[model samples]
Target: MKICVLNGSPKGNESVTMQYVRFLERANPGHTFTTENIGQRIAAIEAKEEEFKKVIAAIESADAILFATPVYFLLVPAQFKRFIELLFSHNAGSAFFGKYAASITTSIHFFDHTANEYLHAVAEDLGMRWTGSFMAKMDDLLIEMHQEELVRFGQDFLTTAQQHPAIRRTYLPITSTRPDYKSAGIPMPLDCGDKQVLILTDAAPGSNLEKMTMRLASSFGKAASLVPIDDAKMNGGCLGCCRCAFDNTCVYTDGFSEFWKETVLPADIIIFAGTVKDRYLSAEFKQVFDRSFFMGHIPAFAGKQVGFLIEGPVAQCATLQEILRAYPSLQGANLAGVVSDEDGIAMAVDELIDSLAARCLRLSKSGYVAPGGFPAVAGHKIFRDDIWAEMRAFFRADHAYYTKHGLYDFPQSDLRQRLSTTFLSLLLSIPSVRESAQKEMKKHMIEPFEKVFSESPVLKRQKKEG
Candidate 1:
């Protein structure tokens, strides 16, 4: 059987993800494997019709399709994403119809599941029989146990593909009707003062997204500045070289870093407006995200407020919404809310604009941030562990920042808590003590809060005022 390997890594053959593919191919010498560097040659593929035709032809001829990519910014690289966009744009979905599909990704186990979920959705959307996914850590190939796991994955995928099993469709096709959004006169004036507001968009001219961006900017009065991603001069997508890890400097001297630092970083509030394509924002929007990796694992937009103005069927795409929510939260920013075009033209647009303005102002003034959810908590812990262990020397900047910000809040580091827990466990080993502790556990947990309220200066002051 002929297998088409869609290599979605900017590093192409040199990518660590591709190394797994190479291993699979070497292990399964009976099957023929044809590799395409879709991510690396995306520009040429887009420019040359024949180059794209060759890729489609490969897919059309293949019995199975393997998507091998490194998880970038919680998804595939921008270039690979652009290729997926091309598949829809060129009406080439038929090439992948009924083909057996599987995905393999290499990451440090940080949101790798999201990437796999995205690929599964994409493959199913393309009318492929989704086999399964194999997620490997960056160093998994080096371990004997992990190598055996990879071998097992390869055997399973091949056996599944050959058997031609029916796979259930997980994601239903999303039908979107573009709403005709028109400006509802001038927005009500708001005193934005010296606050820096950024309206970042990938909206093309005459699109509803563009109109929404314009309306959002207008709602901010004179404070908001529009920064269309298409206008930004980005040389290319992130190389995933880890060169930026050392000092937070990208290999490419593209003006993106300067623009990001100068225009985006200092913003008090940021409005991201984009049209959803495939399962996510446009590839150009993703390019902006991928390129921003130069900032490394640090929270660049900490304390800022962010809102999303989506011009598509956002409610239907739960994964996209989760990604949107996670992005802001991971950056330590407050997600004001997501406004979608599905809410109708006049009412939704006007209400969202007003709400965004009010929310941004309120959050900025109050400095109230929603506590981190699972993504933020899990992502931070993963980064903290990785940085402190293997990446500490290479990512000195992250280490320094983590040290300075007290991000290394490892539970084991608290000696007092450790000693207290040890003592409590020993005491609880006694049957009598265990019975007493079990009865009083709930009360013990509430004691600290009770003490706070009983001996509180703030409550006393409020009582005196009352």
Candidate 2:
């Protein structure tokens, strides 16, 4: 079997993740392996088109792919991510479909499970079946598994790869429109006169994304507005408290409330412009991202054209899902389109205002919803196998993955039962005569309850695994 390993560390060949690759090669000597240091090659490739062609050829021919990376700030390194961005600029669907892709990530403080899940989700979005995750923590234990785990990974990866058919078959779900005949449906015209557009931005004032933002704005009828993100005193950052759902206003009245009332409410199309900081939205953008909820149930941007302007590599669709989940205020808006890598800060702003205007015009005329539907999860339902896989990963006792996003919340209905059990258990226990025994029991009864109150979302496990 021939394979390609796309290593995603900016450290290049010297990364610890490469050590794992060496182990895998030793474990399975029969399989041919070619490694591409994506981080090291990304910068040099700009002047060398042939290098990308070779990389693309290798990817196309490979029976399986090993995406190995060291977790940087809980995501792929910026440079490595850029290489992936470039892949899309080429033929995105052509190279990746039907390939057996697995992820391997090395991290120090945290296990690589979340990072692997992100990659797996990306593969799923690209219509690729996820084989599985081969994740490890790079601590002292790494030395021990360097031999055995590598062999196990090599065998397992290949075994899974063979199960897939060699002939790639693309499945298109049955559509209302016939396959052979072009739908001669009446074409609709766009109307842009009375439409309004709203622009919301991190106000990086001079960034590449601003250009895309302006283009998006102009499409929406020249509707553009800028909301600066760097003000630290505003809203003290979203506390993840869902209070805004009912209150209809931010609890901390920094500048978010003012921005929403004075600027955000009046626009017909809203353009979200934010720079990428550490592989995620900037801190200022994050604060505004969180505070945007102040729009509440009032239908501020409902039926309005909305688009996102991003400054980094192409964002994973799953990350967008997470964002929607975190903020429900965006439910009714029409998602127009996205623009990335704006070229410069000034360009980003110009693009931001222009894009808002354009999006508003387009929204007024075409009235098209974004390719996918609202609350992205609703558009793409969770599969039975995915739920099962999550349960399986959970049962593996990979606590780091569970800690990051899964276990923090409990279902609301079950909370009463849990609280009852805790109260009853504590009340039923009698005090022991020994002081040490009494102290221990009291601590046990009180500590768990305190922890429960402090953490609103209780840890919840799936009732049934797939």
Candidate 3:
């Protein structure tokens, strides 16, 4: 069977993700695999109609489609995303209809599931029979055990493709309700005080997103500075080139750096406004995320209050919601709230927007950035470990930042704790002590936190104080 591999890496065939795809090809010599570097050649694909036709022709002829890419900003690269946007804008969805599809991604395992789920949903939206996906940690392919598992995964995908088994859709189609959102006049202004409120948006002029952003800006009154970011003008997308790693300097001499410095840095509260395009935000909006890779693994929005004003059915897209929530959490920012125009009633959405404004003000005034959730905690560790170890040589800027900010906080740094652990281990070696330790394990765990409750004005007093 002929399979078209949609290579979503900016490195084209040289990508680490493609290495795994090549392994699958070598293992399964019976099937033919052809690769298209859509990520690398997105400029050509978007500019030249003939180049795009060639890609569609490949998809039309293929029995199966393989989406191979590395996860960037919890999704596909901005270039690959733009290619998908082009496919929709150019009316090329028919090429993928009824095609067997599956995705494979390589990442630090930071939000890898979000990327895989995103592709699966996109495939389903394109009328493809998305069978399954294989996710791998960046170094998983180096292990023989993982290699064997990958082989089995490839075989299972091929067998499923040949059989063309019916699969339930993971995401239902998005239907816009009252997308052309109208603000119910001016809302009661939020008292932002000394907090710097910046509303960044990529809303197209006269679009529903534009209206939503306007409403949100007005809700903040004079305290908010709304700037419609031209994130679309940024690419030539991120090329995955590590040039910026050394100094946090982007290769592209764009106005993005200035925008980051001027708009992003001073803001205490940031509200992102955009419409849902396809399964996520617009590719233009994604360009902002992809281009921001220049900052490496740094949290640019740390200690800020973030919110969203979406002009589509964002509330319904769980995967999108998770990604959205993860952005603020993983970046060390607090989520004020995400309000979408899913409600058919304009007044209801307006009320929600007003409530969102109130929420942002309250959070800002209190200077409370809520603790990071699942994505934030796990993602921090992944980046922290990688930056401290193997990735250190390449990411000098990250290393410097991490060291200065005390981010290299490996638990092994505590010599006293290590000594205590060693003593405990030796004590537990004796049979009687071991049995006693096992019996008292749960009690010992609770013992340390007892002081925290009695002394600190923390969780213990939250019920009464809060």
Off by over 4 Å in 2: 109-111, 145-147, 165-272, 275-316, 320-466
Tens-digit lDDT track of model 1 for 311-390:
89988887888899999999999999888778776766787878888888788777877899999999999999998988
What is the Cα-based lDDT of residue 281 in candidate 3?
88
Clashes of each: 0, 54, 0
Clash pairs (backbone) in predicted model 1 = none
Instruction: List TM-score per model, in order.
Output: 0.97, 0.44, 0.92
- Candidate with the greatest lDDT versus the true structure: 1
Tens-digit lDDT track of model 3 for 335-408 = 99998878867789888888888888888888798877778878888999998888989999999999999888
Error of 1 at 341 (Å): 0.6
Model 1 CA deviation exceeding 4 Å by range: 456-466
Residue range 62-129, candidate 2, lDDT tens digits: 88888988765345655565566566556455777778888878754232444676667555545566
Report the error of model 2 at residue 4, Å: 0.3
All candidates: CA RMSD in angstroms? Answer: 1.6, 16.4, 2.6
